[model samples]
Target: MSNRKIKTFAPKGTRDFLPVQMFTRNKIINLIKKIFEKYGYEPLETPSIERLDVLTGKYGEEGDQLIFKILKRGTGLDKVGVELKEFTVTDYKDIIDLGLKYDLTVPLCRVIAMHKDKITFPFKRYQIQPVWRADKPQKGRYREFYQCDVDVAGSSSMLADFEIIYMVYEILKTLGFKNFLIRINNRKILNAILEHCKIEQNKSFFVLSAIDKLDKIGKKGVINELKKKNINEKVIDNLLEIILLEGTFEQKLNELGHIFKENKIGNEGIEELKEIFYYLSKTDIDSDFYSLDLSLSRGLEYYTGPIYESVVKEPKIGSLTGGGRYDKLIGMFLGEDVPATGTSLGIERIIDVMTELNMIPETKTITKVLITTFDENLKQESINTTWKIRNSGINAELFFEPLRLNKQLSYANKKGIPFVCIIGPDEKKQNKVKVKNMKTGEEKLIENNKIVEFIKSITD
Candidate 1:
């Protein structure tokens, strides 16, 4: 006999969801999907793997390094088991050709481009699926996680951007999040800040990337990072003075508008923000839930106009959702650009926060009742009763073995089955069944025909 121990672990940063966890996850997903559909966004899905070129150069430099690239198949794969450990990046072009998707936005753009002729104008779609990243796993981060994204393409209106923001508020509020804020900024405003600082064009992304880390590393850390990038000391100081400007949403906008009054792109971004805020003011959305911040520079290179990120103050896990306008991303696939805006709700992080705060309702099992076989003679009766319960739209389980009554009852109790039916010899003769309520220790003699109604009356 062999005694080798087999490896049974899931890869790092992945998870195996048990039934109970799945119940909670499905509850959250269903709620989000309802909201997405309510807002006229149709559901869409994409393949887990995409062409290497399709994913690369879309996310910025750091993001490009985190893609889980797949090695090419064929003769190159012949040495996988023997020499794969020795492979290097220099061999990538000949060997690696595909990678797991880093996020849903790129794939959505690819879809719009490939099917542009067949799709309608101002196309709206929602996608809920897992994306893979080669990131280091941590408390609230994972290599494989689900992103619930909703995007509207072919619409250049700021209303599209506002709708995305409103939906973020709706989903979080519906999920019982009260202490969250939606931070808004515009790439054009950021560009104006860079130009005002006299930062060279080539170093603009580097500066924005550092500013994006302000939330994590704080003001001092961002300054140190810029210094490491050889950004001039004066440039760093000027950049900090602008992004660090703080006040109410309107106050900050007014200040930025004054500073960038002479800048064309900056004023344009300021106007777009004003338009979105105008729409927000007329809605039921509370002013406390959303705000404008000049420092919220989303790291993705694709974000062209307004950018947004939502954060909860309670758990402090970081942003729960984020997205922005990427009018030029679709143009990479199509010959011309298509305006788009969207947000992705980080399901894993949301679930983590909800679970930590004891927000998910306790749901131990889905089965409502268990029918036990009283004896070998009554096995068929138990099966028949279970089928009747199921046909009546109730979830019921039938005991597989004709074991002792105590043992069968223990099984039902352990599984959290609320009700158990015992069709004993006496009850069988009387055309009745002994129904026991597991929680209350109460028993009732239910007629064979009335068992379904009785269970429904109590369970419902």
Candidate 2:
């Protein structure tokens, strides 16, 4: 054999979850899925790959660059004397036609566009899936991760927006997050600010991109970035003054009402916020859990109306969830526009935070009981007992070999199995099995037909 070493690690920015980790992840996902279903959203799943054109221009410039593109297959350049490393950036279009989806929303839009005829209007759906990005791996950031998204399409009412926010509130509370904030803003208000500053239409995205980084880069960094783009200094001052404006949700809205009195879109955005807050006040949601923050500009280009992000006050990790209304995204696929609103729960980050906070329960293994083979003669008895317990929905594993009883018990202890069932020749003849409580060292003789009940009594 060659002496070269084979790489055994997973690629960067991805992970291989062990059973212990998967148990917690599944628990969290199931909880989130339950909450989504409770809100009248149905489940939907789309393919992992999509046509390149379908995903290209939807996210902003920085987001577009993070997409993981997939090259075409079976285009035999080798037979034609071309090598794989010889291709240049200009040749990508000819060799690449597909890419991994950047997020769940784009593919959903494509689906609605293609199936609008058969589907009902105002379709509410939830999707829990993995999305790929070609980004530098960092703490709590991965190139491949799961996004749990719930969305409502074909509705223009701000009620849909409120539902999305309320569902976020409910989910975080359900997940045992006590100190978190749901920061809400409207793109129309940001657009009006840009207009008030006389920021050119072409450079609007650049200005927003800089503003989005205010949390990461700080005010001075944002100012420097804007200055680099030749934005007038006085205009930058005026823009920051409004963006950094602080007060209660109502107070800030009232202040902006005077600032943008003549600006139709700005006034419309402010009115939308007032209506959402009015709806929120009628509910039991705590006012401290949600707020209106003008600086909360989501990086995606598709968000056209109210946008919100959920963040934990403690660990200082980034957003746990993000999304907003995209009234025009579906229109890209269909001939006409359909109003859509949604939010995506960043499950990976949430799990990381839970782990840090010691919130995830200890779950070493799923096997509840181990059925040990006493010997070759009694192996059949153990096998039958294992199946009997399994039939009753108890997670039971049969020892593969008729090893010594102590060795089988050792295996159960190592795997953290709570109970062990022993059926030796004597017990088999007596029509009974010995069940040992691995945690307590207590042993009992359970009747053959009572095995399932005995296991459930303690485990459940």
Candidate 3:
């Protein structure tokens, strides 16, 4: 006997979306796509695999650790540098040249830089695709997930940031999420606070990442975490105070301006945010839609300017969306700064939140009507009726099985095919069909000449 245990299971942190789940996912994606298109953001797609260098050193230390690095396929390497990432990949040039893209933004940035000459300035684009991460999967988090990103590049104007901010607000509202808040901060401001706190330059991302966890772990917990990283008590204490800096958005910006007045870059950050608010003031956006947040670090080192994170009012699913301005990321390829701002919705997290809230919409059946024949004698009549319905652009399904009447009705019920058009000897003799509403249990006779109209009146 063969001694092998064949296992049939999907990998951890990955999901196999059945029909129902796919319907929900597709509905959410389509809704996002419609909104994106309505905003005049053109769609762009890039290869799923990217060069190793394209991804590394962009997301910061902890973020880099979560990247799913592709391995060298060969058995042995000759003197390869064994640099450890989230996964171990030999730092050999030819060995590990390609890796699955970690996020849509990085690849999009590369596309913009490489094609700058051919592309128009102030370019806007949208991408809806999956990304891979090598992190522990939990609720609202996954190893493989989709990021619906929209970005505008080649402009540093505060208006660009405002457009992205307004876009985020509009997307949530369009998706029927009424209770949410957009948290805004500037990396420059966060950097200023870190500088004021005397956090070492090398460990800046560490501080940002730790503070980003404030929502998950409270203020005291953040301080405890920083202490574990050897951050001084005074530094941690000062950082916490700045994080809790209070008042209205303007008031908070004012306070930061006062504190960082002497600090050139810090004040510049504050001024930029103030101007963003100025531009936003002209819009009819809800006052509570966005607010200035001092502690929002966004946890990504690539963000050199304004940053944003959105949270739902309930269910506590962390950061439904995030994005920021990255002036240096595109420069990594172009060798010159290119101002870019964008935001990405975490599709998996959004789906999870909606599911928890029972907000996943009921799916509509594509096959609007199922045509069943009473017997082989009436099969041809059912077939002709099906084609007539199809010709009128109404979806209809004809059952070929010569099953009993109850079995045919049960099949329609199981498939959720809302309407069943039954063709029997009696109806055929009358040159008519019986349309049964599977949902309402109402049956009506429609003359064959008017069957298409009858179906449209109900199905359309």
Candidate 4:
């Protein structure tokens, strides 16, 4: 035998979803889509691969390096002075200009740019698709994962922002996710504060990334890390003072007005937030789910305005959702500013939290009845009964093994088949069948003609 090890496992950072797991995942996706449509969003799809130039430089510096690139095909690259073996192409843009899309937002923007003439303004779209990233995987984070996104473009109204916020609250509630809080912050407000505080441009990103970890690393840890970055105590204290600044939504805006009185952009951010809250006040929603968290930094380079993140109340799972408003993302392609806001629900992360909390409902076994043939002589009769039961909407499968009656029942029990029907020489002779509730350990004899209804009754 060869000395090579067996290749029996999936690549790291990816997964294979079995039938039961796929069922659960599809159910969740369907629920989300139903809610999204009810909110007047249209379904849209984009190609899984796009020009690397389209995705690169979109998600910040850290995100750019994590992109998975595709290599140039054919042997002709050697003729073009390309060393295929010694130096392989890694940057997708340099090799073929196409790569697997890292997120839906960039492709969505590209679509809007190319199809502007075919679509209407104030376009509302929802995309549910998988994105690829070449990052080291961890619990609740994967290399290949799905993001459920809903976005509205071509409008800058705070009403649209409020509606999206309300949409999130309703969708989570419909999905039975009660232990989440919606954290909101304005990037413009953040930029204003940073500019006013005289924080260097390069230092601002490091500080924002560090502050974003407050939930995971805690305040003290964040402060210590900030100190390690050579940030003086006075700058850290001043930044904290602005973040800790709190009052009623309106009162906070007013206080913010005083702090940013000399800065026009800062005041604009506060005004936009006030309009959002004003519209939010008109809706009857659980106020506890929404909060103005100053520390929230969505980390996307494109987010130029407001930002949002969703975290579970349990404090174990990190934020399961995040998005923000970006003013110039479309401008990169369309040559004009198009204000848009959107959010992406990290499907796997939410599933992890639900599973850990025992919030996902126990899967009800779909196979309701198993038909067993005790004797080969009666196998045809049992097959006929199984078909009749299945025709009547009762899922019944005929046992494959020619084993004893008790063994057949034991196999059905192990498969979680809730009901079992047995037909042997004795029962077939009497034109009857024995139906057993595998769960309850109860049995009853029924006429062969009534087997379908009997199975249906037990299932219902």
- Per-prediction TM-score: 0.95, 0.95, 0.91, 0.89
Q: Tens digits of per-residue lDDT for model 4 on 1-460? A: 9999987998878999886777678888999899989989999999888877898999988998888876655535636766666755555445566689899898889989999999898989999999999999888878999998999999998777777888888878878887788888888888888877778998998888888887778878888988989988888988877876777667767877788888988988888888887777777876678878878887789998878888886747677888888879999999988889898888988788877888777664568889998777888888899899989977778997779878998888877889888887778889999988887889899998887887777789
**lDDT computed for candidate 3:** 0.86
Q: Which portions of model 3 miss their true places by more than 4 Å? A: 1-6, 71-90
| Candidate 3 C-alpha lDDT tens digits along 173-271 | 877888899999999998899888888898887788888888778887898889889999987888888888889888888888877879988998998
lDDT of 1 by residue, 225-251 (tens): 999999889888888988988887677
TM-score, candidate 3, is 0.91
Cα displacement (Å) at residue 166, model 4: 1.9
Worst 10 residues of 3 by lDDT: 83-92
Clashing pairs in 4: none
At residue 431, what lDDT does model 3 achieve?
89
- Residue pairs clashing, model 2: none
lDDT of 1 at 362: 74
Among all windows of ten consecutive residues in candidate 1, which has the lowest summed lDDT?
Answer: 75-84
Candidates 3 and 4, the one with greater lDDT:
3
